[model samples]
Target: MSEAWNEGYFTDVGYTYGYYREINPVFQRFCLLLRGLAQPEPAEGTRHCELGFGQGVSVNIHAAANPGRYVATDFNPAHAAHARRLAAASGSEALLVDESFEQLLERDDLPQFDSISLHGIWTWVSRDNHEVIAEFARRHLKPGGIFYNSYNCFPGWSPAYPLRQLFALHDRFGVTPNGAVERVEAALKFSEALLAANPNYLKAAPQLTERLKSIATQNRHYLAHEYFNREWNCMYFTDVVDALAPAKLDWACTASPLDAVDAVNLAEPAQTFLKGVDHPILREQARDYFVNQQFRKDLYVRGAIRLSVAEQREHLLDTRFVLTQPADQVPMKVTGALGEASLQEDLYKPFIEALAADACAPKTLRRLAAGFSGMAWPVLQQIVAVLTGMGAVAPCQPESAEREARTRCRALNRHLCERARYGNEIEFLASPLTGGGISVPRFQQIFLLAREQGRKQPAEWAQFAWGMLDAQGQRILKDGKALESAEENLAELTTQAGEFAEKRLPVLKALGVV
Candidate 1:
């Protein structure tokens, strides 16, 4: 195994330094899809396993939302520790094991999991590692369990593979991390020069320019780890299918529901011609011709069981009501041919109006649909999809008045950045583990004062800062309407700040300068 495969290296630098904790909605939706497919519900104490649980953010969120036992494993000990901490903090009932997939599969005490997920690992690991993961799924996944895997694909990524190779060569030649970055920059500059020198470069220059720009935007740490990693590779979707065939797993569906919608897939005469092809490899080729896919989230199942459309509807109903948007917000008017037009025709006006009023909770939408008398779950779902597609609706967790107050305070802090005294205070308020995490109410009070007397910025940090604060505040306000009052908001902010001070202040103190 490479040194990167060792537990210590990943723990000491990889998981701790990177911004790896952001929520992945694709994985979350996959879980919901699994929940639907596993209907006629599994026996109690059903479990799910995540093969490479880096930082445990995705699995923790899934475990929190779904009622099941979760077993997560990572080859990196640091990742396992971080995952454990996250699980505990989030009150997620997930068991974290610091072991490779191979070692985990060899254990006799493990139970067959109802679902298995592996993300961002398959394309970056050795073939042996792939075999181990496949073998583990074969041995431990229940007969009808679902397996989800996401990876980089061919054709779309083929153009960039050479660029990656060039970067790897530079990384090998460079002495320091910054030197490696400079070397990559130099290589990109050379490519630009080459394109400028040759008129023939026009055909390939666009792709090269895009690749260069992408690498330029990437974080230094991410660039080093991603390109320098010894095992990075991309595979064809069909090749991945062939690799997993030995494990008796078969493709259930593509993770994206939008991909499955016939209208989206069948647009041209060529699409119709391609759909009739029986061979899986041919189908994939046709798909590539139709769409140059760069990545895919594939869902696989062990058995051949299929669900009826009605069963799928019931399963969708069983999904927990996750509020993606406020209840009163109205959706934008649809001028085009809406999918399942009959379903959307009657409710389109009302749905748009309701969505416009305020962003709505999913439950509130359902209630509104029921009142419409002509509404069906499918129709409502489609409307919600349309609204979501339009960016009119969002999922929000209920917040208290205190949370609202804090958001206002944060906004105030940003605007005050031009005033040296207030700017310093704003920086303190904006610290992630400290001020950023503080309760809304107290932050609100501080912000109100700052806003009244703060210096005006010659530039627009306040605008950028407001954008961030507004997004956070919108989430809180939409989720928890309880924090609407000024007094309630203030109280909540105070409590939040106190909690932050207690839990995160020590780290801040140790770091010293602020």
Candidate 2:
């Protein structure tokens, strides 16, 4: 019998997948680098394939933006089904396959793709499967095709690997879920006690105690899942480069271009040290180690092709910002009559106003929160996501240098937050566990699920929402209690129904059924 792949097991024993909502600019840049390698235009309909197309959200977004004959494949039937549903919902015309990489490669009937992307699947699969992936790229990838693969990297993750092994051992011993949590907590506590016992703990690094303390406080689900995966392993960058050498593939660029930003990029001395490195793999590893890289997304190319940075920038200039026409300028695509009626008694006016800003970027929305100190960050983030989905604002390019600077600054903040102790709480709450806000497609979903069903209200929610709205109305509302007066109750329900109407009305409008 084929080995059973239990999702609960994966959830209980593997690292949770990173759920990024927006189009990753780094992936876009990688595509530009590939286009330069292939000498192709966006209008040329380059054939692209994605391996392990989880949920197909990114593929759908790409298909909507770039017209192409795209193909996607995944081994999990459930995941493939979800991808198909999303594609259908998004009206994207792309072929999705449910099969293994080996089987797909063996088929002569398949179309030759110009680019193939495999993100977050390299280290999780068996070694033989990894070889098959490389072999498929060799035989099927066009001579100048671009292949992007993202995987866990080494040296930085070395200390964590032993912890993972211990978790795996405990998991095999039939430890209860809570037991697993306790065991990890105990391990961390023991580590802390040892440090306390020896005041010379700073002899190794004073920061070590703080780091362990931070890890212990991370989400229990995250800890249990990531540290107990059976196949969790980290390989040196050289090992990965060698693995791809047989297929004549070479590291073209990084999927996350921000990772390329470092002291090496800043100083002549660091640059010279990087240059003297002979092996491409070793050079990357050295740079990563110096900077302490934990995760990576790298782009590989079959052959070398040169393009200037300016040319690359021009290629990526299409539809990079979200545009919103003034409320009166364009006919409201969504029915806001109900929203307007409900707006009279509800205290979410400031929250709604922030969402209604002519055409604000996410960064601007965040910065604007300072003006509304009582407003919660999580609530504001969700409100922005809801408005974006409702067609109140559309995606556009970040036009100003200020926006770019803010983006980089935010990334640096994220890096520092990942390594620090007290900052871990901020990182955890900002992540998907607290609904990163942008990931929620509709406001009604938040209302019906979080408000009506009495979900999403926790100590964290209060902390999260306090950053979005004024203090007068920031109190945690129990299920039906969110609707206080009859006026407020009717308004809340009406707003909820209106949101659904707004979403469904677009389809009718497109079909001339409205």
Candidate 3:
């Protein structure tokens, strides 16, 4: 039997350092604007709460990047303690606790939340927990506030459901020994051999084999908690809408802004056909069938207020943004329901070039529009919106958020870099300029830590990291094999350091991460 903690969710193996965009109030408002939905004003300085904040990476980063009075709860004490450690190190005043949803709702001292977000909370736990979460939203969330919820939705999950069940069954009844990771590997190994025998169901749905292969490469801790949980609910869009209705929550838009663009998300006839559906839930559910979306990140608003065209544009223009990647790196194509669609080069070229020219200095839509004078306002808005959704660009901290975020980011990043020498638990660092954490691989984290101690060149950075590893009595791995000697490890680090310096350093510098 599983532990009573988190209602049988894993506490033994902690969740990964995950970050979700919906938790950032600035980004949330931006995505809602992209979908033409009226959003509550929640810049830094507002109250935000995240339920089931696994590992607390997102909450901590957002807290460090903005001036928000943040609050979060993870039932697992280990997760909460780790999150609190990060907060304390960054000098963030975020109130992070280890409390269940029921206990939290009953607390009299907690403030009413301006925004409530749960990243994939709805898909993992019991229906009782789900209703409790809904009740928390109803009581604690202020009027006209935002609620971000992500989950496993049907049709997209239809193919993998049986495979998950197979893994779970093997864990329960089969002779599994030792830890969860061993059981997961054994279950997977058994499934592979059984499927190779060419059963009828396996033969019919070849997608199952592909899914298993993808699942094989994921973090074992993620897989264990995700699949081994007692309650693994994959509900339809309508089911989710109904579940939140009692909280007086109405679906506003997708938490991911890119999903709002119909041209990229759905093909012509199907997109046109779906437009005819008047009900929001039915329309969303119908779209899911077209895209075969396995996961969903949705935004709901309590008492949603619609924005006028002028008001919408005014709000969108005020949101500051920064370019995170090189102009040449931007993808020219996107996948739609019909097929892959190509983005027009002419429209994106000028914008990308302009952003690349300035690097880290975040510019507003109004400032960006001045450079693309030839392009119409709506077209520029649409392209930028799509690009932001695609992750080529991001909504950034306003002037008000920058100085404070930068200071906190430095403190948090230095702490994270130092921690990397000991373990690989945290792979994220706060960047006050970017107002978020970018994925910093363990190797790169070591490199950053080395660079901090007066190591200017990449080779020096490589040598410094090698010394740390050598001191730790650890060897570096390449192609799943540990190097034989310190010399070979140093050689490997040199190459990686050169590439990182050339490609990643500029972005990191702009983000105030280095």
Candidate 4:
């Protein structure tokens, strides 16, 4: 593998096979709708693009689960190949390219994108690459299209910047000619030793101790790319706003749904102070400092359209939502910049229970609101927003879109489950209901595979899964310890299979993944 093609980007190891939901167009539209901003619908002919789509997990899933055309690029050929494989498996109309940002900028055939997204990219590339992206967006993004950009931001990264620099420095100067993984381990070791020395820097940045400790335990591949990269720039929120201004972008709202809720993230005084700040940029920057914000998932609009209160209410009522997790598993407390706050039980309890009813099928806000005769529309909307922000509930695509996506999602999910028989690297399945990926661990995926093959009982699913694992000489790990014998492993699998059948299968069925 040659390094020249990667520019300064780290290509020593493939990036993680993680699915980020923020890249989903359905999720992005909901984020905008939450802030009373208008975004393009995820209609059949809509176009979306993702720059630096690492493992292509999100792009593929979105392509399969949503009714749209997806075009994505990652400089890494290995990533592009893996992504393309998933695209092929799902029979999705996704164009995954192995082209640099500069190359992508030179292309004239790209369609006008309704949404353009780049996650964990802005801060890791050079200023020139940033310009290329802006130019790309300027030329290709349609008017009123959404542009999602997530990056490591300032003030919050202020304390940890030095630590990252140390890791990069160690990898550059102190490490020997070892593999990327070994080099990462060595850099972590050096950082740990330096922190153990209890230097003055550690005393000034007390958080560094815990941060370093946490870093040591993270995936080496992630650490290598995250810290050992040659170009890592942590910018402020305002800087990003300015950088993308060339593309006619206006800051719309955060892709993080929870940030929309002021009560969870901002105190009354802080909120008042931010409100008094007349400039949007200045207010956003001040809010970041107030929250000590680090990484941000932001959605920008080329031509911003503010929805009227009545219009916002109308659109929200038409939108559909589904619970992403089991109702009982969703915690009543949500943590934000203000720490943990308890959700109003009287408001959320009945709502969650109601959502969980009807076999946990997707429900329109209007229908759900009808069930709560006494609750006001505003209160119901707020409750939906808070639950959505908590990640327990998720907005769904239009019913027509979901129906169109079922074949693609099932194909993609079957491919994922088949892959799970060998490895657990990819741990999510595309869900047409939510228009995103759902967390289905490898065993659960195997269980789904068994069900697909006409296995009727959980016991049969357990046996089927056990057969696959036992052939691979793998044992069931219960509570961090591997089962010693076949009977123990089968017993553990049986219990898991039963729980999966009882808890997750119905939801998966509703999501059209089963």
lDDT of 2 by residue, 1-514 (tens): 1345532224322233344322332234333342343233333345678877665555544443343456888766766776676455435467887787777888877677777877667766667777998888887787767777777777666554544554456555633345656656655555566667756635645566566677777876576544544565467777777788788887766654323323223356656888899986678778776655666667777875767755543443332322232233333232221222122213344544443454322224434465577855444433433344343433332334222223222332233232322111212111111111122222222232233234443332223223222233432244846544444534444554454444432322221111
lDDT score of model 1? 0.53
lDDT tens per residue, model 1, 219-258? 6545655565667768888888889887788776665544
Model 3 compared with the native: what TM-score?
0.93
TM-score of predicted model 2?
Answer: 0.57
lDDT of each: 0.53, 0.49, 0.82, 0.90
Candidates ranked by lDDT: 4, 3, 1, 2
TM-score of each: 0.64, 0.57, 0.93, 0.98
- Quote the positional error of residue 160 for candidate 3 in Å: 2.5
Off by over 4 Å in 1: 1-12, 15-44, 91-93, 174-202, 262-266, 279-285, 314-321, 327-349, 352-361, 364-514
- lDDT digits (tens) for residues 1-514 of candidate 4: 4568887788989999998999988999998998899868778888899999999999999999999789999989999999999999999979999999999989888999999999999888999899999999999999999999999999999998999998888877994456989888888889889889889987789999898888888898998789888899899999999999999999998988778788889989999999899987798899998999999999999999999999998899899889888888889999989999998998899999888899998888888888899998777877888888878898999889999899999999999999999999999999998889999999999998999899989999999999999999998878899998989988989999999999888888877787
The C-alpha stretches of model 4 lying farther than 4 A from their native spots are: none
Ranking by TM-score: 4, 3, 1, 2
Q: For residue 157, what is the lDDT in candidate 1?
A: 82
Instruction: Spell out the clash pairs found in candidate 3.
Output: none
Error of 1 at 476 (Å): 19
